[model samples]
Target: MLIGEVARRSGVSTRMLRHYDSLGLVRPTGRTVGGYREYSEEDIRRIFHVESLRSLGLSLRQISRALADPAFAPASLVGDLIRRTEERLKREQELLDRLRAVDASAPFDWRGVLRIVELLHGLGSPDAARRQQTVLTPAEDAPVPAEVLAEAVLAEADPYVAGALRWALARAGADGVASLAAGVRSEHAEIRRRAVRALAELPGDEATAALADALGDSDPAVHRHAALALGARGTTTAVPTLVRMIVEGTNDVEAAEVLGTLAADPERTDRLMSALAAELAAPTADSAVRIRLAQALAEMPATSAHGLLRQLAHDEDRAVAAIASALVRAAEQRPQG
Candidate 1:
């Protein structure tokens, strides 16, 4: 067959085939007198085998070495890959555990308010501290009031004050949505994040929309919280934004969970299936995301995602592969009336 026909049949691009040939990976069986490459059935089998190995994460040099030896066992290669993958996952989990430990140790500190206010007021400068002393003192002989300096500190510490004020504002009315929305525009990112979470708890269309916009916040944790809040709303309108975040947002587990909710929409099942398939093929995708996608694919009716699930059943990621295999088995066992 021609290059186009081979690509169409094998799902491997023509350019990739040429590159493979250049590397002696899958050389064509014959060439026409006019110099056109012609591949045989054996060549197609070899190409599929190459794809299968590549999907299993074998490097070109490793693949070449394996192909050279007739005694090479694909199962043994898969075992090695699985061992390496587990080691990497173990390291990643260790790092995550350490970060969680650090976060847990440092609870919110109100003392930061004094430090930030002092820096903002230029109190670190010798002359500026002297000027503050003069301004703070009523007279050379008169004692300065502690209450006055405390009030000045509160005013200078705008971010901490704003957070406290917003919390207080939440109690101002039965509807916390409006007050939280106002705080979303606060100069402090932490305040905005808190406000977004607060608004998320309130039930309304306007509040949901505002929280959706908050998913684009500069802080990753804020964006993740926003996605979770929107997911909690569980409305159809939030689906589009959640779907967008699942596709383009950071590799956040919260966002992936939200995407799983959005995938429940019948109208989105096909698109979600396609995205899941692409994710299964992506080298850089998070394992958690891939597993979630596999689970999502498994939950759909047998007819909806059978082919994709079948492809994933052989994935190098054992967890995903097992899920896919179970899905495929369940699909096969379903009775046909």
Candidate 2:
């Protein structure tokens, strides 16, 4: 076939075919009477081979080496092409993410677009201080979007930076709560914990409800954090988890304090004491678990707690007995409320 026919059949432009000829990548094997280039069947086959290799992202130089060098191995070259393709895909995905974030911000002009881009760059900065500063300073009164802040909060490792991000997300309001809620169900324990903590800081019925829902998380740490936060917010659903925190000795002190706060209601006070007493008396309760329960009783007011401590003072476990006895005696000697 002639160059034009080859280009038309192969979907390659005539100009590109001529360029390939100049590079000696594919040269026609015959000539017309007018001295124009003429392609033989073998030459057309080689052109198709070059085009096939090019489809796999092979450079023209690499293709020349591949076609010319009989000793060339394709394994390493193909591996390199795979790696380069992956890198290009990654860059393109990042560009798409940036564009989405800018569009999500609903930028009013080029200035707003630039500001969102700059803020996003700062939020994703490797330096913790830069991330914190990005949250601290709004972009000319344009607050960072809640979804962006929620994403950062879930991945942030630096405690200080994470706190700043949480505070900013809270100020961003309920917009980020749904994103953080997804993090609560994450397979990663750390991410689940971070999500609950961020949700705790965000003010709204939605944030509180999300935290309350997390009370049943399979990860004890997650449910415990959620329980504590919800306890502070007066969510009655956290009561059982709070009691479990005491028994397991995970943040039991804070758990006891929140329980004490929650126990002020006469109805809740009765339930709190009943749960403590039952745990102390349960057949599965070990000495350590019983001791933790005894100690937790000390955090509540003497009116509701001292009665239980007195009964526990006579318990079988000597350590549990001693701790309960001490708490009771101290409660008695203190000034009356």
Candidate 3:
């Protein structure tokens, strides 16, 4: 059969068939005198097998490798895919946890809209934002002009009102981020904090940087919210600012919480361990900060972190010593290289 006929029979696009051929995943059995491709029953079966593996979320590379290796069992391939899917699911769960944490800190009155905004922010995709907006703004309400509701929602401090504001913002697209950014400069600190937090969810480099700036806001609550927003987005640029706050600032507790999540990235393990070591070296470092940093380091699996944690087990503070001991015990359970 020709490529078009094979595509129609297999339900895979002609372009994809050609791509599969290029990858040596599936190839036609023969070619006509004029160079037109001709596939046989065997080719069709190979195409179906490729389609089945693709549907299971195996990448072309994985499928290619599996096809090349006679020793690769189907069950083993499926188990590998399942393991990758589970890892992705775990990452999604972590993002959800960060979103929930941000939602809890948002002003209660605007919790509903903030919750949606939090979810959208966590998604980090335009398509997801649009889908979420559709669910929050029902079809029946589509005809209602946004201006009519914006005034009412923004004027009140109720959670419902805040929710409405967030819904309207999602519907408004990029304008929402701009308007919210302006709102962050409001005279009211609470309003500024809430607006900043909402804007942090919006997509843009400017919005991310603005959230980082908000970390230095005089209000500890606002600063904390900024830290959470930056952490949720996985903005590594804000890590230096957060590290300083946790290591040397007054709001050490809140800063440490945010840094713990940020440092969960294995790439940042060295930086986190180094920072913790520096804090521990300071004789004047607050005991609470030392304990928090030690706890954060313990959660990481880096070898350097394990050494630091073992040393922390001997701290004078009983609570810090106990946490250190627990970390050492946890690390010991892992098989040695």
* Highest-scoring model, TM-score: 2
**C-alpha lDDT of residue 98 in model 3:** 50
lDDT by residue (tens digit), candidate 3, 1-337: 8999888877899999888888888989788889888998888988888878888999999888887898987887788889999999998985675555445434345655455454444333345444335435543312223332222233335554456556655565444454456555667786776676566556677677768777767776676677767876887665656666666655656556666666677787677667667878987766677777776675556475788887889988888889888878888887765
Global lDDT of model 1: 0.62
Cα lDDT computed for each candidate against the true fold: 0.62, 0.88, 0.66
The number of the candidate with the highest lDDT is 2
- lDDT by residue for model 2 over 1-337, one digit each (tens)? 7888988898989999899989999999899998988999999899889989999999999999999999999999999999999999998987897788778888788988888889989987899898889889877645788888898899899999999998888777889998898998888989999999999888889888889878988988889999999999888889888888888889999999998888876778888888888887788899899788878888777888887888889988898899999999988898985
Q: Positional deviation of 334 in candidate 2, in angstroms?
A: 3.6
Worst-scoring 10-residue span by lDDT in model 2: 137-146
Cα deviation of 91, candidate 2, in Å: 3.1
Q: In model 2, how large is the Cα lDDT of residue 14?
A: 92
Which run of 10 residues does model 3 get worst, by summed lDDT?
141-150
lDDT of 2 at 186: 89
- Relative to the true structure, candidate 2 reaches a TM of 0.89
In terms of TM-score, how similar is model 3 to the real structure? 0.49
Local accuracy of candidate 1 as per-residue lDDT tens digits, 85-161: 89999978755643443343342454543333332233223454443543433242322222222222223334444
TM-scores of the models, in the given order? Answer: 0.40, 0.89, 0.49
Sort the predicted structures by lDDT, highest score first.
2, 3, 1
